[model samples]
Target: MSTEVAQNTLSSLLEAVQPPNGGRNIHDPATGELVARAPEHGTEELDAAVAAARAAQAAWAARSHGERSEFLNRAADAIEASAEALAELLSREQGKPLNGPNARFEVGACASWLRATAALDLQPEVLVDDATSHAELHYRPLGVIGAIGPWNWPMMISVWQLAPSLRMGNTVVMKPSEYTPLSVLALAAVINTELPDGVLTVVSGGREVGERLAAHPGIDKVMFTGSTATGKAIIRSSADTVKRLTLELGGNDAGIVLEDADPRAIAEDLFWGAFINTGQTCAALKRLYVPESIYDEVCDALVEVARLMPMGNGLDENNVLGPLQNKAQFDIVARLVDEARAAGARVLIGGNPVDDQPGYFYPTTLVADIANDNSLVVEEQFGPALPIIRYSTLDDAIAMANGLDVGLGASVWSSDPAQARQVAARIQAGSVWINKHGAIDPRVPFGGTKQSGYGLEFGVDGLKALGAPQVIS
Candidate 1:
């Protein structure tokens, strides 16, 4: 489609579009009460959105990198100005504590990413030259990027994809998870005001919308974050177009505590890593392998920490532990807990759902004596459930940690700096933390390996993912 035609198509699409079919009625998973109704987008809407994006892509790509960056910076400013309202909406929709440091941290990261992308030099430029010839290379935008973001960290992940693509001069058509579509829409509102009409658009719905978006002929690339199963399906569907893809899929990340580590420190990190967001994080430390020398000590300390975590509505200042985002997540947590108990594992701390709660709420649970083969240890429970596995040898622990199909993120804890560094190097995950877990910076690239999917999502590497290298001689 011609650039003018595409622009008109996109304008018409946005003007006539209504929020997805599932109009507001979204509930606060924490309180089981109506939080807001989410707008749903169906296949037809998704098609129109993609058409609009494709139409705008060429014109967007024609702009100078500096021009695109300016737009990104403005969008960042808009997001920061609306941080409070966005945080509240996020908490209500996704069940994270609205007032928690994590919520604020997300807002800061969003703005930081936008500003960072703006400052980056992503245009084609010159390289070393010989006497006979001159060599030059330029970064070119990938047209019509299709970003399918997850519910857990909705706005942040969307920005992770959107910022780099937009800065690199690609128009984006995003499909936010139906579970947390409002926050994404709020973000889109900010972008729409700060950017060209078709620069960024959000289409919200269930599987059909995602499927349509992934397979849309106009989309040149697809970036998805969700379960490994869904990632595989997206890959399969994109085969026809051979679209460039970046998939940040499921992860059953492990935290290894060496015998030389301090049990107290390891326990603290483990608590926050595993239980934060009620363990809805994909990179959260789901399986922990503690050296036999510190196993009991670590377990005891973890139990104590888990007990102190306050569970209630996410909007409440005192509530550290919030409800699962939906009933499906609640059921998954409950099933994992039950399965662990039946398989001879002991609950070292909180287990089972909290009574007298309307929403989907699961307790911060620590399960001990969980075998590697057990469901809790092997599968991606994706809940507030942590299973502690004991290891007598460092080699055994490392082997066990890397045994899974997932290679997303891992953490190694040791008092000895050398030991921690060495162990971190050996882990198979894409990002490794030494004595820390779930720590992310916009300046650092993040993603996974193996079934966790491929490609980086932040930093210079992430921005490069949205562009192609063109050589001129």
Candidate 2:
């Protein structure tokens, strides 16, 4: 379909799906335009979506893995075909740059993940071949999965849940965050055209709808990606139904720069690693721990490169960075940066928002010589502001990095790969990187180790997370 046709179709569909109570308005973070409306679906809508999923689950599960995978592949193909239009919508709604490794990149990731997961194979395990009785562990689909996606990297993350769940033969009723619901809606609208009516659905809303979906007994599994606090609430609600859950929650990821590493050599990589998607990424490097010997140099290297990276509206292809996606997030980032500055943290670069900007556009901020206990260093400032702290010893650096309750991801930068791996092994996180941070593969499992979240996504573990393993003798 043409871009104009797709836009009109999406608008009509949005109008059709809008809740009876005139749902919440979704605004473009760059221009503050009323981009779309997220239907404030509540208990009734949640139940209806889950019921549809349940009705479709049987036929979907009855299909062979190959058949299910084919559907996923078709969806991926559809996504790639309409990528430009989708990426444009994503940039307008998500506030990420459309080109130059931003929204377009993310939309590409969604297609890649869907196609990859579709092509992936998982065989039933034979456990006791030599014994008197033979045993086989078969992965069977759960009835219906309730997937709640966060706003940051909305399209890719939703596919991270939907692709695997559908590949495992489970139908899904998804709830994309109200902040950026249009992307998911547009994506699902395209993909669902190829699949059965109830196989996949998107219900847009805030907390109430999500609560109902998690608590409802119709859903066999709840796969949520969002805040730690919200994850806890889902846990409490899902407890009553004893629903299986896979939560990918918050992260205050830290990256350590060793004295042996070249700050200038890795400066650009480090900058993108932390500030990709304007640092709204859950796995982005929020805190940088630099050795006292090279702390100043590392700070200077980051600021020098960060200043050159353009920040503007996502539609402008020249802009590598875009505005914060929402006002709440912008305020949070502002408050944290201001508090850190008040606490004697040195602002090495852009510390303030673009004065009187149309939207929530904060500058690429770098806090130097900040104490580990400072809020900017301690909390997850999910924006472009990064805090670089000085550490005297490796032990202290590791301690400071591991001190936080959130441990989604961490990285070590050093000249020696082996040495970096040794230190990486000491850090408590789900994924650790050497030289780079947040470069994930579709075949590798990605998850968190502590309060960040539980259950894995991607690879064999991800496939199994959507199903029940039944051992047959």
Candidate 3:
């Protein structure tokens, strides 16, 4: 679509969602300018959406898988058609640069995920077959699915949950993060163009609405992606209804640089892995452990790469890094870096925020010579700050990497894939990368171990997660 058409589409979507008396005003995190207002839905609206979804589920499920897949394909087309408009709105509201692997990448990901989910083969399994008797295992839709998404990658993550649920023949009722509700709402508006009425709906509200939706009798399953604390709360709330859940919560991922690794060769990848989405990614590398032999080398290489990346307003194509999505996140990044500086850690580059800056723009910070127990190293500073710690031995490095209670993802960087694989086997994370960190593929299953939360999210398993298993003879 042309830029003019895309803008018109976005404007129409915002107008449709805005309440008559106005609703919550969303502002640009990059410049503190008013972007738009999102509807402040509550429990009543939640009930109506769920009721409509529940009413639509049976007919949606009754259709053949091929028919459902076709609908998903068309939804993907609609998302692509409005890709430019969606990216612009997402950049303005979510504080991600329009270029690079930020807003446009996220918008494109939504469409790609839709297509991937639609194309996945999910045939019934022949559990048992004897001469006189036969049995088959099949997956059926589980009524209405409640998808609660995070703000970091609002549109893409919503597709991660919504596409599979819809493809499995279940209708979805989504509750987007309050910080970036407009992005999700706009995305739902584009997607709804290709879907049947009530097949998908977005309820942009506060925590109460989410709490009610999790426990609501009409919602058979809840798929949530957010903080660990909120995931725990959902667990408690959903218990009364015995609702099934798939939670992808907080991740303080770690990365290790082996003694034999080439620091210069891996510096750029390491920097992007940790700082992608300006470090708001749950699976982004929060802690780095480097052997003393190449500690300074690795730190210097990372600093050099970090210095080249420009940070500014999201609309500026020359910039790759943007502000934290909200003030609370900015405070967390600022506070953790401050604590690190006070604790005598060395700031390599971009530790201090520009006081005169208009928005919540914390500079990309890299701290070295930090202790493993330091708050910055231990905590999930979901922003553009990385804590690099030095270790004397490989054993010490492995122990420090595994020290955290949450292990969603971890990476082992080395010249020898064999050695990396050996080290990877010892780590406790759900997904371990040999050379790259947080390189998630839609075809691969991704989740977390321990407090990072459970249940797989991609590939065939992700499709099955949204369905109820039954055996027929």
Instruction: Estimate every model's Cα lDDT from 0 to 1.
Output: 0.83, 0.89, 0.92
Over the stretch 187-206, how does candidate 2's per-residue lDDT look in tens digits?
88878867888999888777
Write the residue-wise lDDT of candidate 1 on 1-473 in tens digits: 12121111222322333343547567778777776566766888888888888788888889887888878877777777667667777788888886544566676778888898788655456786778888888778878899999998888889988998898889999999888887788778756767887879888788998888888888889999999999999999999999999999999999999888888867777799887778888888889998888799999999988888888787788877778898998888788889989999999877867577588878888899888889989989998889999888999999999999999999998889897898898999999998889888777899999999998988888888888878888
- The predicted structure with the larger TM-score, 2 or 3, is 3
Count of backbone clashes for each model?
11, 0, 0
Worst ten in a row by lDDT for model 2: 1-10
Clashes in predicted model 1: 11
Model 3 alpha-carbon drift over 4 Å, by segment: 1-8
Off by over 4 Å in 1: 1-24, 123-128
lDDT of 3 by residue, 1-473 (tens): 22222223667767766777869999999899999888899999999999999988889999988899988888788788888888889999999999878999999999899889989999999988989989999999998999999999999999999999999999999999999999998888888877789999999899999999999999999999999999999999999999999999999999999999999999999999999999999999889999999999999999999999999999999999999999999999999999999999999998889888799999999999999999999889999999999999999989999998998999999999999999999999999998898998888999999999999999999888989999999
Model 2 off-target regions past 4 Å?
Answer: 1-22
- TM-scores for all predictions: 0.93, 0.96, 0.97
Clashing pairs in 3: none
**Alpha carbon lDDT of residue 376, candidate 3?**
98
lDDT of 1: 0.83
- If candidate 1 were superposed on the true structure by all CA atoms, what would the RMSD be? 4.9
Clashing pairs in 2: none
